[model samples]
Target: MATGKYISYLRVSTSRQGASGLGLEAQRTNIDNYLNGGQWTLLKEYVEIESGKKDDRPKLQEALQLCKATGATLLIAKLDRLSRDAHFLIGLQKSGANFVAVDMPTANELTIGIMALVAQEERRAISRRTIDALAAAKARGVKLGNPDNLTIAGAERGRIAGVKSIKSKADVFAKDCIERIIPLRAEGLSLHAIARVLSKEGILTARGKAVWTACAVKNVIERIEGL
Candidate 1:
C-alpha cells in the first residue's frame, strides 16, 4: 500500500457514542484496516462530538487547516460521518480537500450527483413528516419551537478579552518607545539620523537591535493611543 500524508477525521453524533467511543473507535479501526501495511503517514487525527445537523465542527476545521498547510488528503471512514445532506458533500468536494470515504469507495462524480438528487428528496420527505407531526400536535393543542442563544457568548467574551490583552501589550511597547526614543529623534533627526544617534550613544531597543524604522516609530505612537 502506497500513501502520502493524510489527516483522519472522526465524529460521533451523540454523547452516548462519544462516551462509549463506539463511533470513533469504529472509524479508527476502518482507517487502520485501510492503511493495512501501507506507506501512509497519519499526520493528525481530529475528533469531534457534535450532531451531523451542522458543519461548523471545531476539530474538523483544525483538521482541514492541517491538511491545507501540510498538503495532505482527508480520510473519513464513512460519508455519513460528515453529513447526510448532499449539499454538504458538494461543498466538501469544492473545498479543495482530497477526500477518501471508506464506506463510499464507489462515490465518483456520477454517484455523487445521484446522491445529491436523493438527498433533495429526503429533505422533502422530512419537511412533509414535520408538517404531519405539527398537524397532529395542533389537534392535541401542543405548542413547539424553542428559542435560545445560538452563538457562544463566552467565545465572544474570550475574543474581546484577547483584543484587550493585545491592545494593552501594544500600548506598553509604544509608551516605552515614545517616552525614551521619540524625543531624541524629534531633535532634527531622520530615521537613519536617529539610528546613528542611538548607535553612537550605545543605546539599543528591547530586542538589542540597533536599526530603526519610521514604521517602528509610528507603531509606538499608535500603541500609546491604545493605552
Candidate 2:
C-alpha cells in the first residue's frame, strides 16, 4: 500500500483539453484507483499543457519544487503524461523528487514479447536501410554489376563511410539519453523497463522513432560498454 504524501500532476497536449478537463478526469480516476486503499495524503494536483516541449512548464517545476520541499512523491497517471523532453528528465533527477507512474506499476512477461517484436522491427529497418542505400547508390550512377574488384572495394568503402555517418549522428543524438540510461541500467532496471522509461520521456531512438525498444536500449548499453 502507498504510504507518504503525494502531489499528483496531470498534463494534456493542447489547451483545449486542459480547459475542458477532458483528459484530466481520466488521470484523476487513475490516481484515485492507485490510492484507493492506501493510507496516503494527496497533497496537491497541478496541471500542465506540454511541458511546453520547449521545457517551459512552470507547473511541472512548481509541482517538483513542492515535492522537493515537502518530501512528497510526484504522482502521475502515466509516464508520458509528463514531458517527453530529456532535459526535464535530467532536471527531475537533479531536483531529488520521487515519482510514481500509476499505469506502470511493474514489469511483466509481456515486455519480453515486446522486446522480440522490437527486434523484428529492427531487422526490417536494417533491410530497408540497405535497400534505400542501394537505390541511392544507383541514383548516383554507381555500377551495381561492376566485375572489377576496384568497384567492389569502392563500394565497401562507401558502406563503411555510411556506417560511420549514421553512428556519428546516433552518438550525438543519444548523448543526453545515455546520461539518463546508464544510471537506470546500473541501478538494475531491465532493458525493456529502460526502454519504456525513455519512450515515456519522449526520447526517441536515433532514427527518431517514437517508442524505444529493448534492442535500442541494448545498443546504447553496448555504446556505454565501448566507452
Candidate 3:
C-alpha cells in the first residue's frame, strides 16, 4: 500500500490528441487505477502536449520543481509518456525528483538504467536508418534541405538549453539536500538513523519520497564527500 503526496504528469504527442483527450484519458485512467487503493494525496496534475523526442517540457519542469519543493512523488501513467529518450530518462533520475510509472511500479534505478541503455541503442539505430534514407534520397536527386529542417534544428537547440537550465536548478536542490545530510552526519547519526531523522523532519529524498533508506542517505553523503 502506497502512501504519500503525488504530482501527476500526463502528456500527449500532438495537439489533436490533447484537444480530443485521446491519449490523455487513458493515461489519467491508468494513474487513477494505480492510486485507487493507496492512501495518497494528489497534490497536482500537469497535462502537456509535446513530442517525446524533445526534453524541453515546460510542464514537466514545473512538476519536478513542485516535487522538489513539496516532497511530492512524480506520478506518470507510463514510462513512454515521461520520455522515450534514454539520455533524458537518465538525466531525470538525477534531477532530485522522485517519479514512478504506473506501468512499472516496481522499477528501480537498475531497471531504469538498463532501459536507458536499450533506449539509447534504439535511438542510435534510428539515427543511422534516417541518415541512410536521407543519403539514398539525395542520391536520387531529391531535395533535402528545407525551412522545416531549419526550424527543427532551432527547436533542438532550444531543447538543449531548456534541459541545461532545469539541470542547473536540480543541482542546486541536490546540493541543499547534501548540505543538510552532512550536518546530520556530523551529529553522530548513523545513515539509517539519519534517514529517519530527515523523514521525521519532513525532508524528502531526491525523488521526493517521504521515506528514506540507509543506502539513499549514504548516497547523499557520498555525493557531497566526493566534492
Best TM-score among the predictions, by candidate number: 3
List runs of model 3 lying over 4 Å from the truth: 80-83, 140-227
Candidate 3 lDDT over residue span 135-223, tens digit each: 99999999987655468787898789999986655455557667567788789989899889777654545554546789987776666
lDDT of 1 by residue, 131-211 (tens): 999999989988665333235886677689999986665555455456656687668666666656544443334333434
**Structural similarity to truth (TM-score) of each candidate:** 0.54, 0.45, 0.58
Give a tens-digit lDDT track for model 2, residues 111-151. 32354455456556877999999999999999897465368
Where does model 2 exceed 4 Å of error? 81-83, 106-227
C-alpha positional error of residue 205 in candidate 3 after TM-score superposition, expressed in Å: 36
- 186, model 2: CA deviation in Å? 60
- Least accurate 10 contiguous residues by lDDT in model 2: 107-116
Q: Report lDDT (Cα) of residue 151, candidate 2.
A: 87
Indicate the worst ten consecutive residues by lDDT in candidate 1: 201-210
